[model samples]
Target: MTMLDRRALLTKAAWAALAAPAALGGCASPAPLRHDPFRLGVASGDPLPDGMVLWTRLMGAPAAGADAAPLPGAEPIAVRWEVAEDAHFRRIAQRGVATALPELAHSVHVEVRGLAPGRWYHYRFLLGDAVSPPARTRTAPAPHELPGHLRLVHASCQRWEHGHYAAWRHVCAERPDLVVFLGDYVYEYPSPPDATGLARTHTLPLARTLADWRERYALHKSDPLLQAAHACAPWLVTWDDHEVQNDYAGTHGRGEPGDFLQLRAAAWQAFYEHMPLRAGTLAASGFGQLQLYRRQPWGRLAHLHVLDTRQWRDLQACRAPDGPARAVRPSACPELLQPGRTLLGTPQERWLREGLALDANSQPVRFSVLAQQTLFAPRHYPSGVQSTDSWDGYPAARTRLLQDIADIAPRNTVLLGGDIHQNYVCNVETQVAGRTRVVASEFCGTSVTSRSGTTQDKVDAIRRLNPHVLLARCEERGYCVSDVTPQRWTATLRAVRDPLDATSDAWDLARFVVEDGRPGPQPA
Candidate 1:
């Protein structure tokens, strides 16, 4: 049977099973037997050449215990998994069975090894009679090998209530090697707030408990478009303000009292449960913190530096009517414009500086790509309006970051950002060695489903003020596809016709490419 057929059948079966229990007067439970398995879908993430992580959850009712817990006397069940070279399970390369217990919500995380590099493989989870759909994954390219070509798709800000995820369907069809989810994966605020913004078409009844978060994830995952995209390639994810709370800084919430430690802990736990991340166990401290910042090398073509900007950033000060002149006039908001104020914190900043130094001297690593969230270019509201939400609010910090990039002077450093619901391509210019130097290009992707009215026009106005910007597109909803090679790196902005319509099609709105020695983007 085809995948669509299988999915349809599963949907019908699930609905029937749910309704059967009520009609039978609770005499016959429609719950799957203990041995009848295949619960949650299969997923894989954090791909490495030597190995990758596999994940799955056990099946159970919403409340199998008196306390309404998922599983009461749930014993550890053994799950068997296999990775094969073919989809038919003919040549099995690696196999293993893991025990799932209640402590981890009956979820299994298997870090398998002994696999070939730069090759595709199929994997699945098995119990007694139930089997999950086959998932396809690939390993990263070797360290020094110069890959002829590399393709990647990036997207962000998927608000479930706003519209359908048709863009994800289009991206899945492209079959990218890696999928980069920038931020705002899930919103935490409840519905029906006092204030309504342009992006606030559909609001969720606030998320309070872990179950609320899980339900939200399930709703999104139920969308075939997103699931298909996840199944197509391994995903690298990061969270924005909405994932926890809007404008939350460090361990504090927006305007809540008491210690925010409890909320932070809960948010972290829920995040781990849904993502395909391997739980690393360390001595004394139990499991180590989930390290989000890291560098991935795609052969000799590019070095992708994934950054976490929200976790450690200082809160931005409100902008004045006349811009920085009036806002930082008395230095009352010095912390907001402080040179040492950081988005990646002190330690991460140091680490990134070191990584850039190494990549600048390395012969094999040609392009230095920074995958981050938010617009790096200086964006102002209009002639008189101003907001402290973007990088423009922190001029000193932005200058420092630009100076560092200029100092390194890598062959080609490109920044890919999301959040702000618009598209932009700008040149990062700064003063170096008593002379003006421009080094690197940046591409800011528009939202996948969020609303962005008049944003594109504002970006256009900013481009005119800042000549370094090559292009900007605001009035569109879509994702970006990038092609990386040794000689040049090209990025295409694909825009969807409309988000409200289910049958909307996608087309390339703009295209830009950067050569080996060039520092800025040019029309392809």
Candidate 2:
């Protein structure tokens, strides 16, 4: 061949090599990417009456970082998704193509629309010939149409190293209508030195960069039980501090401020990329600056106001740079009593207040639900001390919110939360002119696998100081399942006796109920 012909042939060979992976079903891994592109499984979230967000990530070849992001210059993978009326997908409802962009970690989030109200739909994604396992998702009930009953499981604090995710497997078996996650989805640090007798170990250390965060998320997602739970139902998720750094507040680190914006931005990006969130959550800069606080209704029966407390809160008062968690009395930490110290940032606070007002006055919903992170009810420790990281530290803000609840006086109000690693049932109360009155009922679920930070002695002391707290269990590792009706709401605590055992059985440890128009829970 002539010299020019030889050069052209060499160019063609290079292009063919680049296209080989795409030809062989887009398996980009060293052994050729497998047909199982659904290793992370499929998930749906942000349910509305008309639609929900369907998600899947196209894992081409296993990249250098163990599926943490993709190869630096890997070609964009073409992904197609479909929603069907049948599990077999014989009756196609919606289908579309979404390019899995490399910059966004090859993840595809399709906000599938035009579905029937309060109905289940099956969805799946296709990358060339490889198809993801089908997932089932449901839309919310129609407005003003009462759903006689709503079943949901709200959980948080699933530390990978502490134990097995048997609780998640159980939750999938229970098959609630929706799963609300409050926070601590993944711990930022790997298995720390102080984490004694852990059932498992994290492969990575503290997560700092985007790649690190992605790998951490992948590690958590690698659990089959967790993946089964995500596939089983639609999830409404909000993050707590561990999604970034532990105890991080709005633009503030746990202790003194430092140059953490870059870290925060990276963490936020990783969170959004992994979650089955809507398209609107994506920021122009690829960081998750999305306002996550909003309301969803189960027809006219319940209005759930999901909240984000960590991304928009003032720093904890009297927190030392490096030491144990700080709890202080009124005299020592005067900053704790400041009226301007807010857990929900100003904009979110206003939004929530206005939403509550609208629900109570104009909409007239039966139950107004506050779904958020941490304890909303006051927890007073012995000797007038309180945890600075929880609502106890932001008394003024909590009081303001309670006042809002009292002003409108919804027929029934319930608060759902997590993050304390213990189950608690309390009567949310507020004092006016030396007279204390219960305003709502709150149920905070325990961690899925992590150990409880509250000691039994401390829990007993706290119970004594806060009389409205009806039940507190600091030793269990499990989740809360709620059955809601127009007449009452019942929450049952399902605990895993041994979180280290993958095959261990979970039992209902306790159950509490709040009657309509009542502000406290009683043993049911």
Candidate 3:
């Protein structure tokens, strides 16, 4: 049988299974009683070789000020979670109870463990007599196993008002081993004033309070395509600026002079409540200061180092009128020359340096993929308008990071980034000891729904400026899928026809492969 035939068969089977009856209780139902509804469905994320975090929320009837008020007569409720080897739950591997507290907005995150590696498992939550839909998750590949292949989809920037998430449907169809959400999962700003000709129109303004953020998340979660994608695989996620506010720097709000510390605290609390993060991993700083820089290994094929760039970085400088008018010009801005500016902050930088060192010694880890947000290589505006945001604003810090990569000299270093609503492949460059050194290759995924003006023009300009950049595509919107093997790591940039359309087709716009010991991406 052909590969296309197998894919068609699998798609048919998946849709058929979705229509099948869900697990039902054998016993008779009692008198109807008030029970918290499970509206958003169950999800699992942050998978490790031995464990993963499960998530769910208790949806109650809409109340006056449901967003803020404690649920009437609220009490701590026990949420029992179980992980089983099979979908039938006959052989349970892990089980535990977590408290659903009103303080946490009735969300539950249970981290389950004591499971075997490189295996698929099913998990669910039990609240009182009701059970949630089972969620499927897989553990990281075992060390030294050298699995034949690993597939993962990377996406970001899902602005609710921009358009529909039809791209998510294609991602779900792919059935990747994992999903890495780079960031901008939610935009905190109010709907743009000129939102005409957009995909999905916004119904409200910027998110200010916790309830506002919650409602925004609820709206996005209600999308069936996104939910289907989440249900398909365990995800690893980190936040960018929009998760709190646009252009927010450190503890400061965007241009607004107020108690930023308080705002940051609120944003952090709401973020933790809505995400599928392990309870213990939640931060107490109230400022969303959790350390998310961590590494995961997939046998000997790859090691992923996920980083948080927005939380600790310095404020992005405004573009200088007298300097570069185009954002894509590398020499247009002086802030890019700042001596001490940082993207990962001090602690995260230290952690990454240490982690890269560790990967250097580990034999099983071949490719060190920095799964992060923002374009690692310098990308300026084509019109000669310098961007105050992105790595270009902090050239010294980017230089430091590239230098570190050169020092560690992993077998192959690749930076996977998302944001900017465009896809790009660039060769990362920096200067060390007065010597120009190229460190790694970077692949930036385009937006899942967000819009950009120069999606097509930027691609052409990027290629013109950097020959090392193998490909660029700005006009299209879609996600990227990576297939990793012992010999090579291949990336396919998939683009969708139109996000506003109910049905959109996805096709591979470009393909590149990084062979073992190679430092750059080559067209496949």
Using lDDT as the measure, the top candidate is 2
Q: Point out the worst 10-residue segment of candidate 1 by lDDT.
A: 17-26
- Using all chains and alpha carbons, the TM-scores for the candidates as numbered come to 0.84, 0.90, 0.87
Error of 1 at 425 (Å): 1.1
Tens-digit per-residue lDDT, 87-170, candidate 1:
999999877666554444556667766688788888887665567778888887877777888888889988765666889889
lDDT of each: 0.69, 0.81, 0.73
Encode model 2's per-residue lDDT on 361-449: one tens digit a residue.
87688889999999988887667777888998888899889888888788788999999999999988887668998889999999999
Write candidate 3's Cα lDDT for 1-524 as tens digits: 24565345334322221211233222122223265446667777887778777777766655564322233435545566788889999998877666565555667666666679899998887766778777788888777677888898999998877778889999988889989999988887667778687776656567777777777776677677787787778988888878877666676564344655556656666676667775544433333466566777787777889998877887666443223212434454556567888878988888988888877886737788899988888765446655656776777788788888888887788899987898888777667788766678888999998886664655687678766667777788899999888788899999898878859898998998888877778888
Clash total of candidate 3: 13
Rank order (by TM-score, best first): 2, 3, 1
Q: lDDT for model 1, on a 0 to 1 scale?
A: 0.69
Worst 10 residues of 2 by lDDT: 13-22
lDDT of 2 at 461: 78
**Residue 256 deviation, candidate 3, in Å?**
4.6
Q: Name model 3 segments beyond 4 Å from true.
A: 1-36, 62-73, 192-195, 255-258, 318-335, 380-384, 431-438
Candidate 2 or 1, higher lDDT: 2
Better of 1 and 3 by TM-score: 3
Any residue pairs clashing in model 1, and if so which?
Answer: 190-206, 191-204, 456-474
